[model samples]
Target: MQMSNRIKEIIEVILNSKGYVTIGEIAKQINVSDRTVYREIPEVTEIMREYGVQLNTVSKKGMAAVGSLEDMKSLRISLGMEKQIYIVDPRERIDFILLYLLQQDDYIKTEALAIDHHTSVPTVRNDLKKVKEQLGVYDLHLIQKKGEGILLTGSEIEKNALMINILLNHADEATLYQWLRREGDVSNPFTKRMEEYGYLDVMSACYLRMKNIIRDQCELPAMIKDREYLEYILLIAMMIGCHQKGQPYEKVFETENFKGEEQRVTRQVKRELEEEFHILLSQEEEQYIKWVLHMGMIQDTSSVYTVKNRILDSKIHTFIEYVEDRMGLQLIRDKELKESLYVHIERALTRIRSGMCISNPLIEDVKKDYEELFGIIREGADRIFQDDFFPDDEIGYLVLYFAVSLDKVMKRSFRILVVCSGGMGSSKMLAHRVEQEIPEICVSKEVSLVGFGQENLDEYDLILSTIPLYIDKRNYLKVSPLLSSNELEQIHEAIKRHKYKTMRKITVREQERRQLESRDNIESLETLRLLMDTGLRVIRQFRIVETREKDLKNNLLRILSEESLCSLPETEEKMKKQQSYYIPVTDMVYYEAVLARMPEPKLFAAHYHDDQYLSNGEKYTDVIYAVYPDQASEYEKNILNRMLESVIEDRDIQEMIHRADEKGVRQWFGYQFKQYLAELLAV
Candidate 1:
């Protein structure tokens, strides 16, 4: 078998190591399986033997190098390890083209690029096609002028977003900080380190200097919440600063989004930035800064799920129920699924409201992979929403959320190995606590540090260690022996990290065509993006009521009379008509736990008139009303029923009644009926 480049690296590590290292250790370092190492070891050994350097395998210890020091030195020379030349992968030439264009004042010839990379001009043209594909993701298009040259033209926000993606993709936590700390040229080792993450080179040192200046001069408002977001804002700042050296100010094209207080905040930020950097800001630069503060840093929406909880909850229920009926999957009981799908709905609503046109890079892959699921989500959304407006990208996200949950639901129990200290006292305590605290951890094996060496590391999904170990890796955890609050939190974080790591590894394998396909991998990534997004569409419709009407029955009848479409004064009479045409099933859901646990006392009521009711000659307008002095909680979000069905139990449904007017009641009733169709279809 032909030895791969990775195998060659492994040979170097084995040969240079002072002591024997196990295949597990090497595999962990390389982010592969021990079986892969085993497969390649023989080939590496054959290559090593040609230089008279022997590969020695110790039974339980691992592998070692046994040969003359000069012979080993000669082997390194033969492999060109001394001055390794980086041959950029074909997949990464696109990034090179992008970075190359970013630094240019005008479009350089494609032939120049081909010569720089020592490739044919046609190859450079092909690379440009891929560059266009990538730019399309950021909503920026490549402008190939007939005679002048090629360039990128888009809103400054879009440009900043793309630059941030390229600059951050190659670096880890340490290297990112390194660039921020050092003030020198950033000689990124792309071909050696960032082969998996696309290779591109930009003057990161200059950018980081701007970042440091920005940080030192101003205190960013809390609205600039995340580090990644702050970085994007700084990139925009750098671009503006770079352009400002020649022109004191530049005029920005789009100013409609920036007005009044937003414009003022933008000016203040610009003044502060200019003073710190000793530069002057133009009207355009000020407006661009306003764009960063408003859209990039400050929130465009209230918060994720800040909308009427019951309305969102109802939508989530309808989505899940519809998906269940269509896909034949039992999804209602999956709390994690419900949480994720609910978040997707919340973020989707927020994105729509914010008017931010974002595209999913994997939309094509999602459409191709889970065509049926995507259709089910779109169809289900239409059935649930009055005017469903999910873009294909949004639908892709929804499919991913559901697909990942389904994949997990279909997945079997995963095992974890717990490696403790040599002494059993603390390790046993931790082991027992781990078993008790984390019920999701289905299976576990307890072993000492030395005993861990005997265990097949591949068989277990994770390794939980109480003490620090020499070989730390993905799916490995180090925790305090006591399993304290912090330790438990670590366990929680470790689980999440392990999940993403596993998903990423699986995706890499699948994308490389090594594996057939893992729906879980793609879905996991989609779910990850939704989990990261924060914002929600805000609506204020809930009402509070206080009157002599203390009785639940009286309130129900009075609200029905005021809100019902049929003008039926008597709810009893309306019920009789509904019974004749439609069966009214009422569920009394208790909010004892919800009410007692509510942080604030917020009471509201809502009523929905069944669309089917008042159809023909029916005198009854089907309306359901519930009253509660509490906020809309998750359990109470959706009242699952047909015409004239009432739920007095859920916090959200009950809370809607307190402040519900005729219009609000009627609107809510439409949502309830949509969900009703989902439950009806299942039966």
Candidate 2:
């Protein structure tokens, strides 16, 4: 035996003797690293399973040797044979190279083959020879040079020809489909060829089914299905047997009828199965299918009668009564197989056979309880929005609201803030429920009714009211008469009917209206922008003229000390003109005067006034003073940029500035000015 075989044997003995050997122990016994020992376990387990030997783990902390000594010996022998690589015929070397390339790294590195193949440089060279030989088979070339090393070179269109050949010759149809499903990009030439050959659709369906089955049957161990065969049979069965046309069995059921029967039989079997085994079937319909297959395959008439009697037995009846008492399902009354009734019955039987049962009934009892709880909340939110008194139960209703909320987030382009009064927990509940309804309309910020008066409501696109909030704001879009689940459904329908494009158009119209108003509002924005630009200019001047030490001190002193011009105290006389004034910039008086003019003037100052250069006014004499002027250095430019930033903290304005910068405005201006100078000289 090889050295690797001997090491593997010693590790296995330690694992069997210890019941659970640590990585360190395995390494010490086998003379390998802990990683090697850990990696070997999975490989060894696979080899052992083929020989009827089992390895079981206890809580993933301990291992157990499950089979007898004889079983171990059989597994050891099988494992030795399994580890050996099958030799490729010389003619089939190209097929091997194609397989190898399929498993290659992201970049086709020509660094000698990866160590795992356990081959020398010369052996790898010979392997490349085989690979090159195979490329010729596909009318392609294996390009190699001293520095460039090896590369598979060919027209992208013909590249897949060799891969297809290998798939056809070396791999089974099912394996080929599985491989293509994972590695073959649909847009790739190879995948397109497969699709053109009509194999891709079947492969996709098989892959989808496999994924669905894994997700649905959580506890069931994965079983590798022959995807191609499964897809072919399923398609035929769906087309023929489901249609009940030209089939061996004349009474073949259509999809609808089959579905109905499945529901009915499933409910019946579930009831009986639950009574006998007490296992609650997690996936009732899937379990029903298995039961149906078992029923279809029955050979004995006596067995059929025995099973049928079991379905109608008193034990089953008693269990049904238990389900009713616990879950409020009066099952005895509903003799007709309704969808839910059939589903419940099937699930019940499935649970019994599986030996895992839950007392929770499959009827509407659960839904009813949740519905009643949320209904009360919906009523409270509606009443609160209407300015009615909130009841004591409003707090409990709030929790249910969030539980039923939508599980999506706002899109990047839009944002909305939800505001509500503190009482009855209506604000939280409304926020929860609305988020549930329209996920894209996020509650970016939540403000209580008390603090809501303090919020800058202009930031949000939509203002949803749980109550009729009267603040003299007209721009807000309101969905009134706060909604229940039914009402919300109506709102959703209205929104969908309106369409996203229409909503966007409305948003655009609103924006345009704001833009018109901005003309009057531009002075305040201009003054703000000037302030930011001034601050940035001051910093830039200090950086360029003063040493690092002086620059730091100057910045510190500027922030720490207040100038008389920066601070303006409000008198009671001036306070009368404005009910309240929260000063944002040093030139509050100037800013307020700008705001007083309203929409039109403000728009001109903000949009039309090109004040980016800080050249609009004299140093310290203008709304903002520039720190440096002579050289107009980068530092001075940075200061001007900062003042403009402070002018408006709005994200949209900043984004506009960024776009302007990207357009190379300075370069454009220089080119135009130079051209004008040349024209002047010519004149």
Measured by TM-score, the strongest candidate is: 1
Could you say which candidate leads in lDDT?
Answer: 1
Per-candidate Cα lDDT values, in order, are 0.54, 0.39
Q: After superposition, how far is residue 624 of candidate 1 from its true place, in Å?
A: 57
Candidate 1, 507-577: lDDT as tens digits: 32223221112336676445333322210010122233333443334554454455334343544343321
Model 1 alpha-carbon miss at residue 385, Å: 8.9
Query: What are the RMSDs of all candidates, in order?
Result: 24.0, 29.9
Q: Where does candidate 1 have its weakest 10-residue lDDT segment?
A: 531-540
Q: Candidate 2 at residue 631, lDDT?
A: 37
- Error at 600, model 2, angstroms: 21
